[model samples]
Target: MYETEDIAVVILNWNGQDLLEIFLPSVLKYSGDAKIYVADNASTDKSVDFVRSYFPSVHVIQNSENGGYAKGYNDALQKVTEPLLCLLNSDIEVTNNWLNPIIDVFNADENTAIIQPKILDYKQKTHFEYAGAAGGFIDKYGYPYCRGRIFNAIEEDNSQYNDIKDIFWASGACLFIRNSVFKKLKGFDVSYFAHMEEIDLCWRAFNSNYTTKYVGTSTVYHIGGATLKNSSPKKTYLNFRNSLFTLVKNTDSNLFIRTIIRMLLDGIAGIRFVLQFKPQHFVAILKAHGSLYLNLGRLIKERKLLPNRSNYYNTNSIVWSYFIKKRRKF
Candidate 1:
């Protein structure tokens, strides 16, 4: 059985000294014997030095460069020897006794490869966070929505989701994963860089016959958009590009038909942005499509080598359900 000491709480940092100073204490105080690590992405700021000087007990692994989330974790995780890897974000505030439930779940289910605890909003404590509210699920078109969050409609927590359940993807903000499973799956695709890479990883895990779960008893509060704000067009770009990349590489059935439907739906979103006077996001969608076209050849090649990816979606179309029919709550 997995124990507390077998876990490694590795926080991915890129010039976020302020966030580390604020949130690192709770992780250190309550983690028991689980090793805490600050995986720095070659920060020019004092992130590594500060963690080294002040939080001397916390191990620091300096990556060669700021490879965003995907490669930063890939590079740093090479040095981490723990059986269980907790990919905690710098902006997450983990609570007391968070590790035990995750360990218990891992020990109970041998096939479970990934786990995400209930992520509440750090700013609004009563509400579920947008990133991974009570775990994540994807639509047939590769759009991801959560149990407590679908599109922009986030649900208020009243002990409604405080139960263990199976999930499609666990949030990267605070994710628990088996190190052996991660190694066998070959880690996150570096092409994604950031945004939805965890979903891609989880999708691959699902295809490999491994389970991903959500244990709501273990919870953490995440300061959503701390690194990349929702307002930024870059976030829009990555979300669109990486999502398409993931859809092509992992999803089963007719890739050509699914991609066409997704792009057409995205066109509607771009028009909506135009009507809303957010032209940058519209352009971001177009650029995202262009990148998809450019890399489609390589993506298809990658998919050909992989095994059968069957029954990946929970819903046929989340866009129709959320925007058209207004089934906001998931």
Candidate 2:
């Protein structure tokens, strides 16, 4: 077991006053010895003042303008001095003993750089929330799938993924990472303003030879879509755009080719959106690819600095093992 006193919990709040009221109390009650920091992204609702007034001990950082999600946390993380840092969304509530298990995993294994808790919905207790359902996995095609989420499919938690295991990525909704390792990786890539930024960070950890894990013993409740409001046009754009950038920035040549092939297949899936008159989905896909091509020169320069450039894994192997034979219900 880990000592809880060494952990610092950091939350980024936009215009979520209602969520802040519900979320802060549970965090204060359950997080033993964890200092709380609320980074307000220029919320017009007076969220910073509210937090400061109600929770005097909590540190509140008020930005001048609305910085996107990744940048908001990046700013707050700079001030965190604890051994472990918990990056949580404002729309989450922790249950009993939620913090210790994740801290224990980090304490137990020095190699474990990032750890995430099992997250459930606040109202529907048995259902897995959309943000990060029981940790995330990536297929060889660079497509990311969560234990309870496949593409657009989100399943109920059902205690099916309660066992602890190494994961490809942890949800930014409630991710825990060692401060030292976070510093080593330099935190989230700012190019990705919000969506898929965590995946990019985790991919970097994988390439850096560190492990990311899902610790099932810890549990929290999430009011999913608080930030993006599911399927919003801007959200869809960021998800597609950043995922494409993540593939380009991180993948080695062999996997890069495979990822491109799979992306082409996934792009074909967008044809149905066009046929059905869902112009936003089609536009999101095209814009993502278009942005990538537009920045091809910059991406090439970024790819050159990756440390393990030659250790690319096979996309076919990932597809057959994780997506096909496993039939793991995403």
Candidate 3:
């Protein structure tokens, strides 16, 4: 059993009344003694009122405006004083006793700053989810992938990745982290607005000599792309732009060369998107590169202020491996 009243499970919401209605019950039912909170992002709907009336036991904090995911959490977490912070997504459904396993791991390891449970798809329970399947890892060029997922290929759950292990990054979909560490990092980079902010936070933690782990004993079902549909061009824009921001801010001394190569590779990806009759995605890549170019000087100054971590990537080039060698399975 885990310690009572030490965990604060904070869900960041933004106009997701239906999602909160359907999924919040499982979280309340299985979360046990951990305090649950709904941090609304200035949603115009009656979501806050609904929570106040039906689930008054759950705490509610309203932000002044919709600051997306990164800033929304940064603003709300200031009011929470729990030792352990679980940054849960509003679209996820928790299983029975899911928090105990993660809490046990945290209690066992003093160096573990962040932990992510096994995330499976809510639609297809047999397959791993795309946001974060088992755990997260990055390649030489700063591309993120998971243990049970690589690009578009997702592995089935046969208990192959049941053993807990140190991972490069953890998914933000259902992440557990020490409250101290979250404050130390000053939360996520608000400039990121939405995507890849979690990976950036995990990379910073690694540089600070902290460990991120995957606890396979615990699990949750996530409705991937519920907030921003995967097919939306705006989603593509945010992902591409934010990934470039993460690379520039966190990459070591070889930032110039790496950024150049990454942009070239991105060009090739844009061509591939065009070949697939997705010109909107192609334009998204171009816009991402343009934004990166415009923010180059500012990002360089930001890099100078941080401690460099050269040992960031697990593989040299996940792009080459997946595309050329056809190494789809991880």
TM-score of each: 0.99, 0.92, 0.98
Clashing pairs in 2: none
Q: What is the C-alpha RMSD of each candidate to the true structure, in Å?
A: 0.7, 2.5, 1.1
Better of 1 and 3 by lDDT: 1
Give lDDT tens digits, candidate 2, residues 1-330.
Answer: 457878888889888878889889999999978888898888989787788888998888776667688888888788789888899999899988998777777778889999989988887878887778888877666777788866555678777888889888999999999899999998888878888999999998999999899988899999888777666767767887888788787876665676578678657757867897878888888888788889877877876777544443323444455445765465
* By lDDT: ranked, best first: 1, 3, 2
Candidate 3's C-alpha runs over 4 A off are none
Worst 10 residues of 1 by lDDT: 303-312
- The Cα RMSD in angstroms, rounded to one decimal, for candidate 2 relative to the true structure is 2.5
Displacement of residue 123 (Cα, Å) in model 2 is 3.3
Where does model 2 exceed 4 Å of error?
Answer: 309-330
**Lowest-lDDT window of 10 residues in candidate 3?**
1-10
CA displacement after TM-score superposition, residue 320 of candidate 3 (Å): 0.7
Tens-place lDDT digits, model 1, residues 79-112: 9999999999999898999989999999999999
